[model samples]
Structures are given as C-alpha cells and as structure tokens.
Target: MRIDKWLWYARVTKSRSLAQKLATGGHVRVNKDKISSASKTVKTGDVLTIALERRILVLKVVALGKRRGPYEEARLLYEDLSPPPPPKKHAEPAVAVRDAGAGRPTKRDRRKLDAWRNDT
Candidate 1:
C-alpha cells in the first residue's frame, strides 16, 4: 500500500492529503531512510518514523488495513514503538500584578509601589 494511504488507515494522520503533505515534507521515514514521496510503498514489517503536530512516532507495520475504521481497528495496523511522552509541566504564577490600561499610578499607588520595592 502507498505510504500516505497506510498512514491514514493506521490513524497516523487524519486525512490522506495531510499524510501526503507529511511524506512530501520529508517528515516520514521508512526503515530509517527518508521518503520524499507520498507514493512510497509500505509493506508489513516495515518500520516507520513520522513527525506529527505534538510528537514523533515510531511504528512497525503490522497490517495493511482495508478501510479507514475506528481507532481500535486502526491501532491494529501498526505496533507503536515510540517512546512515552514527557510529563506535562506545571504553570508558573504570573509575576506582574498590574492590570492592563490602568493608567499612571496615583500618589497612594506610588507609595505602595515604593514600599513594595523597598521590601523586595
């Protein structure tokens, strides 16, 4: 099967056009060799490395699926060999407390700012 078609059927890409773009953009590799064409043939047992939006994937082809099925069925087409995703980072608290477009500081605000600065 064509590499792009296989990618779509395997649920690697949402659409065949996107798969074609990915393959032609030089983001798809087969058995460690870079493939620059969407028509590249892929057979069972071939290994694929694809760069997606948020993560990279390494998959070993298990089957050439007949149709674009549900996620469960599509998963059977390839064996995921990619490493686990990194843990999410925690959000940091904002440093600046001033609101936007608040205008210049008043006398009291200046005194508070001076006090806050001296303490810091």
Candidate 2:
C-alpha cells in the first residue's frame, strides 16, 4: 500500500493530502530511510517515523486498511512506539489564599484603623 494511504488509514494524518505532503516534504521515514514520494510502498512490520507540526510519531505498520475508519479501527493498523510528551508549563504560579476579611479594608474599617493609630 502507498505510504500516504497507509498513514491516512492508520490515522496518523487527518487527510490523504496532508499525508502526501508529509512524505514528500521529507517528514516521514520508513525503517530509518527518508521517503521522498507519497506513493512509496509500505508493508506489514515496516516501521514509520513521522514528524508532525507539534510532535513526532513512530508507528509500525500492522495492516493495510481498506478505508478511512473510526479511531478504534484505525488504531489497530499500527503499533505506536513514540515517546511521551514533556510536561506542560504554566504562565504563573498558583494563586495565594487569604483569610476572610483579609482582602481589602472598607471605608469604615479604614476610619477605625485611623482612629486607633491616632489614639496610640
């Protein structure tokens, strides 16, 4: 089966054209050799390395599917060997909590504080 077709059937790519671009753009390798054509033939047991936009994927072809199917069916076509993603980072630290009435003082509270300060 064609490499692009296999990728699509295996659900590695969302569309056949994207798969074709992946192969032609040299983002796909079969058994460590780069593929320059989308029509490259693939067989069971062949290992594929695909570099997508966000992350890389390594899958071993288990079967050549007949059509584009649901995720469950597509998942059966390959054996994933990719590494896990790194942990996500946050923009800021966790928020700090304060006791009740510890937030902002009201106008009356401020007047009382002023009176206490003046008396002292």
List per-prediction Cα lDDT, in the order shown: 0.93, 0.90
Question: Candidate 2 local accuracy as lDDT?
Answer: 0.90
Model 1: per-residue Cα lDDT over 14-70, one tens digit each: 899999999999999999999999999999999999998889999999999999999
Q: Estimate each model's TM-score.
A: 0.74, 0.74
Q: How accurate is candidate 1 locally (lDDT)?
A: 0.93
Report the C-alpha lDDT of model 2 over 1-120, residue by residue, as the tens digit.
999999888888889999899999999999999989999999999999999989999999888999999999999999999999999887753433336879787798778877876776
Worst 10 residues of 1 by lDDT: 90-99
Model 1: pairs clashing at backbone N, Cα or C within 3 Å: none
Off by over 4 Å in 2: 89-120
- Which residue pairs show collisions in model 2? none
